[model samples]
Target chain A: MRPLDTAYMWDLVPVIASYVPLTLFMAIVAMAAALTLGSALAIVRVLRVPVLDRIVAVFISFFRGTPLLVQLFLFYFGLPQVVPAMTGIDGVTAAIIGLTLHFSAYMAESIRGAILGVDRSQWEAAQSIGMTQGQLLRRIILPQAARTAAPTLMNYFIDMIKSTSLAFTLGVTEMMGAAQKEAAGSFLYLEAFLVVALFYWVIVETLSVGQRRLESSLGKAVAR
Target chain B: MSCQIEITGLVKRFGDNTVLNGIDLCLEPGERVAIIGPSGTGKSTILRCLNWLDKPDQGTIRMGDVTVDAARATKAQILALRRRTGFVFQNYALFANKTARGNITEGLTTVRGWSAEKAQAKADDILTQIGLADRGDSFPAAMSGGQQQRVGIGRAMALDADLMLFDEPTSALDPEWVGEVLDLIRRIADGRQTMLIVTHEMQFAREIADRVVFMEGGRIVEQGPPAQIFGNPQDDRTRAFLRRVG
Candidate 1:
């Protein structure tokens, strides 16, 4: 309603920027956790391991089907209520667990699709060389799957960095939480939000360039 | 040090369709056998089954001291079968991510547990043998189909396999490139490499194989020395197949 505070927005940049590392930490930890858990889930689904496969299927479906915010609230607030022992769990840990599970469900399918996208001949060729199931996956299949998954995985990571803002709901003072507190005091909500948005825009653009370089490098052998 | 292969009553079925049915084959040490047949007659399936790529529905396979029963071949037994034999694929399934040298050294370092230096030396020797020493670092995508298959041969060569199974190795090659690959196989044959080849290249088969096997409808119709099968003709089906291909 009032004139936009261009000068104040510039002032708030450092205040918001100071929290960048916290946001990055949450995203990196969650992405790393998700990638590992997601790959495991993918291999389980691919191998179709008996009871374990069905359990993973339900986990993936539940996490993917539910909203991430609801999951975070349920984990951080509702979890401790039901199980008093879990009340000791902190906000950042809860936020990370939520993000990891939520993103891993999505990542499981993409990783699974990439793993299956690898040619059947690769399996035969690896097996023909007397590679064990572990060796075959480690040396042949996963390397190729990593290439196929790099772009999409990077996409998930970038989305994850943006999504870390939701950590504020659980009382984690990440970049978005910092900005919200700043805005609450100043009543310059639009300016503070815009400053935080610019920070995210910069981070995502830098990562997008990185993603392109990664895709190209990973694609070197596959380039035809 | 070629090993003998005794495959008895080998059978394979995909769903309701039978691909390999009651195939019993025996190979003397270092004996090269070529399997020639129509497209869907299970020629490739036999080679794949021997490699344990396709689990046979029924039979027993004995090579060297290791034996595998189709009904219940353990993981270790199947791996043992594969370790003893090398396979050359129709489409040159060279690992796309690996260079020519890397593909050859892969089995050496991983399965055989050789030192990297030793593996590299073996890979280099194979590259020279395959006449692709300069192209050893090239990826499969960079090489021609013939070159890729040669590297495929080199990968098998690195294994020092007792039996080499060629599954239409040159079938996917360009017409111009087929000769070079067949010539390479002939050179391997000249060394008394125990090979079982399934091929459409009748002329190459006759030239390289000690015995030519004719297969039809998931069974071996006739098998004999190249001269007897190709020249003297035993069964109506073999003759018909030879005639049609010719």
Candidate 2:
């Protein structure tokens, strides 16, 4: 409020930057796990598998309806309280599980829409060629679905990276935690937080560039 | 196996609407049959039923060595029948993610168990046959409707299926482009490919079909040589249809 301390913010950059890898690790691992499960859930929903689809619907609804912070708390604190054995799960593991469940639920709907968005004709054509269901999905449907879903999926991933900030509350010393500690020690809250904010901006911008490149590459076949 | 298609009691229904009523037909190897009817009369349904795409409510379809019973066709039987048959869709349903060449190679490599190299060679040959040799790398989105349908034909041709089915392939194309696609189909028929085509193109049907079938109300009213059907029709419905369309 009085005066921005440029020097202090600049100095805090490296200290907070060291935790970027831990932040990225949480997001990357969670995203990978979520993408796989989310895609499977989408496929199940598309195929309308009896019983399993209804169960997956309930699972998706619960995860998607709840906040990520609340889910993390439920997994890390509530679960352990209810089941003493769940106490074995450390903070990092709890955070990853929470992220995976929450985002996978959201990503499931987007991916389902993308899969459905693929032209119906593609399915008939693939079937006419006598391709097994697996071959049709792997060779034809998913490839086209990936192109339609990539942009949305990448958005979810970027949101996920930012969401990793909440991991600090789970007692993991990720980027946000590093900044909180730095601010608490030096009483330079503004400088510490601003530096971490810039780190996130840079990371997200780099990813935005990556998303564009990926979209174009996937678009080669349809590109005029 | 040579494509000897024997369809008996083929019936298909959509809820209360029966699309293909009990129909019996037979095709010896390399026979070219064209089905003509109004849009809702299920001319295309017969082709779809043969490949089990529409799943007949009742009937038995025997294509080459594989036979599929509509009431209880297993996954294996359906796939077996489909493998021996090729289908071209009205919408030119080319795989958008694949190039012209890739679309042709897809079934060859995956369904036929051909090596990638072999599939690529086959695809290239088909591309040339379809007169789009230079456009093999082009995607469906960029191609004209004629070119896309030609690629669709090439995709089916590369499979080297015992029987080929075309469902109003030119119905979705611009009038100008229809000729080129019909031309490609004619050339493929020249190779002695057993074909069953459902079409609105009366003249094309007349020119290409060894047997011409007229359908009404989900049933084949009459079928005969192209000369008899066109020059001297048999049934009242067939005569009315030819008059209305011609």
Candidate 3:
């Protein structure tokens, strides 16, 4: 009502843009690490390897059931007390670790479902054709599973980007953290929060568009 | 090229019921054998057992020089035997995510260690032979049921095995489409690639089989040349099955 206050909003743009790379860095690293870890866990679970499956199941369930913020807090605040080596790890590393552990659990479930969705006859056919267990997975099973799980994995990446905002609580001065600092200094909470929200919206929309393209191309191989 | 298969004392049980009590079959080189029987007579189970997809509780399968003990063979020897005996499932079972080309080339390139270019060339040749050459780039779902089934045949051909096994290859196709698939299979048999087929298409088996075997309750009740097995049955079960399936 007081003339829109366009000047303050325009001035905060560059300051927020400076933190863009940090936010992206966290998201990309977390996504890569999560995919690798999650795929391994998914393979272990799907094979139903004896005692190890139960351990991985418990680990995935625990990470998936809890809030990402609580995970970040635990890694950043609580972990250092329990493990001494974690004391020297900075806030950024802590944030990455927290994001990876949180998203990997969700991705594991997606991967497991995709692997199982491939028809049972495929496995029998592969075995009948003399494929070793490793060969069956590498040549036949994983490629098909990857196609089915791509859309779900992309969804996790989008969530991971949004979840990076929680890193501010861990003392990492990412985009949201930078905004919070500026807001406190200038007493402009509404303006700073609005600008940060716009940045997140832009990133999420861009990712969704890219994800659609990937799904379409992969869908060609899968047919239906 | 030596093509001989000897299955002895084959026994398979699922829980309390025995699907295959004891099966012993012997075939000469380049034998085109057709196994005909009614449903639940374990015709399909014989093909599955021959490939070791379902292991027999006791017995030995000797294809060429390799011997597979259904009850006691190690995993490595079992795989070796399977590699030489190609199988085509009734459902086709083409890898859904792979193109017809990819489906044909996987075994050639992966297990046999052929280069990708060579594998692609082989796939192209086989697709042409199977009459699905134009559908190579297409996915399984994009093609009709007949085309997909043809690709299934190409998949087995690419393996270059001494013996091929078909378990009701045309049973899943629509009535009109069944002929196209059967025609392709008949052509393959004409080439004398050595095949064991389990089929409900009585006319097809009559035309292509060198030896016809009528199985009932996991045992071969009657077997001879098509003329004797199809025209004259020595067992009542075979006679009744022919009346019903006819």
Candidate 4:
């Protein structure tokens, strides 16, 4: 085995840190889009409106069943073939879209479960209070459901941060992509891979700390 | 501005099982009425129907100028009608995510378009009245059953609704805690808001209710003043039922 070069390894830190903003940019956009789309899907499922719910059910199943890598390829590679407009979009945009679609399906189910876990009597009580269905959901239901769904959403976001590494396959020069390029030139796969792993671990740990704070606040609101 | 409730020929059935069968009654404005009946006899169903929570098979519920044919009222009409009446559940169905104050003021701010400050002031007043003034910032699960129910009452009272509906409020409380909730209801009733209660506490009914409605087998077996019904019930079913429960 070759000897380790501590200075060479230390120099890669800033180079890798430069890609931090892009990785974070992708994750934040993906999380926001996923949450919005997921909320719509959750509401559709909860309302169970005739034909739309069936389509949403199928969409959720289809997205959740396949591997995220496969879905990413399908969106980045397969979609451009079907739609000429998508061909002009960059790899980062394609990856973000794919992440959003893939995770929103999972997030929707989490949100739906949270909404359903609320006591049945709440619906009756809201109705008895003369709240319209929309009013009931916006004012009464969503706030409670959000508390239960927040931890799950944060977990998905952490998964999404790791998942964004997969976007390097789509040719987006994100953190993982930058690492791969550096390792390929230097032939120092160990250092490059270790740096990427540390980056992911640190980011995930930060999110987990935030999640703990959220859980504590929710705890204060409801004893259990 | 009289706000009496007149329910007539109220019939609700789910498949072959009838929950309320042609039940008819008239409640004067500010009348403290208690409905007592066995399980599955639709005691709760009647209150639910009054608010159009469950559509009755046939009936008319008149609240002021609004008339709801529980059998056929439009969704919009029923929603409009329900605003005048506040319904409380046995489980104290407070919104779990909301602080006690939030739960109380939500309806006032949203439904009535009251300013947040005004609603908060009213909520504070009602919470104080219900003996939970200090617990306004607390959530439902953080409180006891009785305290939660008091918040629930404060929630309903925030509406300043004409007719408050209590569906077995004390039935869900611990034996020792039951009196606290009943006393709160009695005080609310004394303040002259019309209230219709469904209760199992015969003593509270006898003491606080201006009229007691005895229901058995989905129909009113007997209905009269508490003295006449609880002390001197006419129907054998009411007598036997009271004897068993008492």
Candidate 5:
């Protein structure tokens, strides 16, 4: 409040950077788990697999409709009270679970749209070659869908990286949490928050570059 | 190593609209049959039904040891039936994401369980046969329509299918590209590969088909040897259709 502390902000960069790995670690793990689970949910929705399809629909609806913060609290605090087995789970685990469930709901729709976007002729071509449904999906459909979904999925991963900031609410000392603690101890809230924000900006910008390169490569593959 | 095909009482409908009605057909091994018809007259539907791509509401299709009852074919039976056949789509439905060779090799490796080395070798041979040896690495989007269609044919041919069903193989081609695709089909016909082709090219059909069938209103109006059908048509409908097409 007195004045912006430039020297303290520069010093706070490394302190915040130390926690970047933890933040990235959470995001990476959550992204991987979300993609796997999301793909399964997408396939289920695409195929309309009886009762499981309805269950997945409900899961997607509930997770997408609710707030991620409430979901995190539910997983971290409410879960232990209701489920005895969850009582032993730590804050990091709860945050990861929340991120995966929340993001997977969004990711499932992206993947499903991508799968649907593949030309109908591709299905016919694969079937004409004697592929069973599973074989068609594995050998042909999923590969193409993954390509179409890649840019969107990459964007989702970037979003998840930023969303990892919310893990601080669960008391995990990721980048944002580290910044909060540093600011509280030194009364340099502006400097500490600014450093953490820069960390996220750099990470997102790097990923944006990667996303563009990925899209152009895919474009080349399909370019006339 | 070819097999005859017998299709009886084949019926297909989309909602209340019948696309095929009581179609009965028999093909001697290595016969080249061309189905000619108006756009909505079910010629393409018949070809699609042959491969079970568009399931028939009622009928039986017999190809060698595989007999699929339209009403009762299990998944395994359908797969078995399809394994013996190949389909060339109107739009040159080569896998868009794969190179020309990849499209050919995918079925070989994934369905037939051929080793990658064997599939690649076969795919290379097919690419050369289709006159696209240098374009094996080109994706469909990068190729001209004629080249893409040729690659599509090569993909089917690589399967060594006992029966090939071409659903308007050149219908989607530019006028300039049509001749090359027809020429390729002619070469395949010369090899005596059993084929059922749905086409609008009257001259090409006359030259390549052993038997020519004229279909309308979801029914075959007449079917005979190409010479008889083209030179001395007995059915008024066939004569009218041939004249219109011409």
Candidate 6:
């Protein structure tokens, strides 16, 4: 009912800022984990490895088809209920697992496309030089695929950073969670939410700059 | 070790469309054979089949001490056969992500177990030999098509394979640049390293090939010394193909 409190909004900035590291930490770790696991899934799908290919296809379809919020709840709430040993899993851990699984499904497809985008002649050329399949993959295929997939992967990381807000529902006091708690005590929900949005905006803007720099450098490497 | 190549009944099919049908070929060590054929007559397929890049539906291929039965070759046998030969593709097929030197040295260090220093030394020599010594650090995307194909040939040469297979080496080059690539290939031919080249350049083939094999409809319709195939011409198909291309 009262006019929006400018002073209270200013005070919420540092409180939310204090939790930025935790948000970043969750996103960074999740991004790294997702990259490794996603690349493996991409390779499996590309190679169409026997039973594992079907299993990975199903896994990707489920994670991609479902909502991340639901998946987070399944990891944080449902898993512990079904599996007693998982009771000890904390909100942060659950969030990381959720982000890794959900984003990896999407990332796997991007990486798979990148791998396929590499010319078929590259494989033949590598083989003609006596390279083993492993050598061809590690030295030739993955490097090119990584370059092709970098910008998209960076976009996914930014998305994952923002998605870290959902971790608050599981009781982890990250940036959004901190803001929500700040608003609950002060009854200044708009101010708290505005500050949180600003923080995400700055972080994403900074990353977009980095993404452009990376793409330009890669472009230069290939430029005539 | 001798690097003779003997292929018998090499048949390749893509579902109902057969690309290579019951081909037989023989090459004594150091022979330079140019395979000239119409598009889709399977000249490229023959080169690919030799390396098991395209698995022949039915065939037996022997290179040096390695023999591969296309239908049932073991993984080790296929690898062994591939190791004995190098292939230069039509489109230059240089690794886009690597510099010219990296493309040359990758197989040496990774597959042949050469130390980094040794591989670099060998690569440097190959770069110079291919007339791209200054472009060793340049990526394929940064080079002209001719330069990229030179790097492709350099990458193959760095492997020290006894046999080389070229599938239209200069076909993808610009008209002006094609001469430089063909010149480099001619130099390699003079070295007598044993080669099977599938090419469209009649003049280059006449200059470099000891033997010329004319293929049509997935079969070697005629083959003999370059003088006979180019000048005399035994089969009507060979005469017609040469007439069309020349």
The all-Cα superposition gives candidate 6 an RMSD in Å to the true structure of 1.9
Quote each prediction's TM-score.
0.97, 0.96, 0.93, 0.93, 0.95, 0.95
CAPRI accuracy category, model 1: medium
Error of 6 at A4 (Å): 3.3
lDDT of 2 by residue, A121-181 (tens): 8999999998988889888989778778889999999999999999999889999999999
Candidate 5's DockQ is 0.70
Off by over 4 Å in 6: B1-3
For every model shown, the clashing-pair count is 0, 0, 0, 0, 0, 0
TM-score for chain B considered on its own, for each of the candidates: 0.98, 0.97, 0.97, 0.96, 0.97, 0.97
TM-score of 1: 0.97
What lDDT tens digits, residue by residue, belong to model 5 across residues A1-224?
A: 37888999988888888888888899999999999999999999999999999999999999999999999999999989989999988888998999999999999999999999988898999999998889888877898899888988998999999999998998899999999999899988888888889899999999899889989988776643
Cα lDDT tens digits for candidate 6, A1-224: 77878888888877888898999999999999999999999999998899999999999999999999999999998999989999999999999999999999999999999999999989888887777877888898998898889999999999999999999999999999999888899888888898999999999999999999989998776532
Q: Which order, best to worst by DockQ? A: 1, 2, 5, 6, 3, 4
Worst 10 residues of 3 chain B by lDDT: B1-10
Kindly report which residue stretches of model 2 are placed more than 4 angstroms away from their true locations once superposed: A216-221, B1-3
Model 3 Cα lDDT, one tens digit per residue, B83-105 = 98889989999887789999899
DockQ of each: 0.77, 0.74, 0.64, 0.59, 0.70, 0.68
At residue A127, candidate 2 shows an lDDT of 96
Per-residue lDDT of candidate 4, residues B65-94 (tens digit): 888876568987888777888888999988
Best by TM-score: 1
4 or 5, which is superior by DockQ? 5
Error of 5 at A214 (Å): 3.3
Q: Which number leads on lDDT?
A: 1
Give native contacts recovered, as a fraction, per prediction.
Answer: 0.78, 0.91, 0.72, 0.67, 0.81, 0.80
Candidate 1 per-residue lDDT, tens place, A75-186, comes to 9999899898889989999999999999999999999999999888988999999999889898988988988888889999999999999999999998999999999999
Question: Which candidate leads the pack in DockQ?
Answer: 1
- TM-score, second chain, candidate 1: 0.98
DockQ of 2: 0.74
Clashing pairs in 4: none
